[model samples]
Target: MKDMITHIYKGLECFLLECSAALVRRRALGGWRSDPRQLREQRRDEFRARKVAE
Candidate 1:
């Protein structure tokens, strides 16, 4: 019983840590972009595409 409780506790701790990491990453990027540079390039491309489309 104690062992089972310890295992569950450890699992919860790991899940919490993963959740924290995801939150940090989301806050850091401000969205779902994987990298800051990638996000910038994506925006630039999008602007160019819009200009071309018009």
Candidate 2:
């Protein structure tokens, strides 16, 4: 009984992790992109410039 509960808990943890990662990916991508060209353009626009030390 205890082993079964532990297995179930581990499965739940995996499920939660998968869902969270999917959400994070969606947020990072700024939502879904149906068109390939537009998606590329959108991604390009999301880039940021950083300062470099000389």
Candidate 3:
């Protein structure tokens, strides 16, 4: 019974670690594309202004 409990506890620990790692990876990826929409809008405005100047 003690062995079974230990196994379950270990499994839970592994699961928690995996979840934390995934959360960290997700946060890192989120930072990469954080302002994509805003950046796209800014780029479009700049492009339009450049065309007007030309």
TM-score of each: 0.55, 0.56, 0.54
- In candidate 2, what residue range of length 10 has the lowest lDDT sum? 45-54
Task: Output the lDDT of residue 31, model 3.
Answer: 54
Candidate number achieving the greatest lDDT relative to the actual structure = 1
Clashes of each: 0, 0, 0
List per-candidate RMSD values in Å. 15.5, 11.4, 19.0
lDDT of each residue in 1-54, candidate 3, tens digit only: 999999899778766865565456547657555566755565567556755975
Candidate order by lDDT, decreasing, is 1, 3, 2
Candidate 1 vs 2: which has more TM-score: 2
Error of 1 at 37 (Å): 16
Model 2: per-residue lDDT, tens digit, 1-54? 999999899778766865665566566767764455765564444332111211
In model 2, where do residues sit more than 4 Å from their true spots?
34-54
Which residue segments of model 3 deviate by more than 4 Å?
A: 31-54
Specify the highest-TM-score model's number: 2
lDDT of 1 by residue, 6-49 (tens): 98997787668656656676677776757867655755675567
lDDT of each: 0.69, 0.59, 0.65
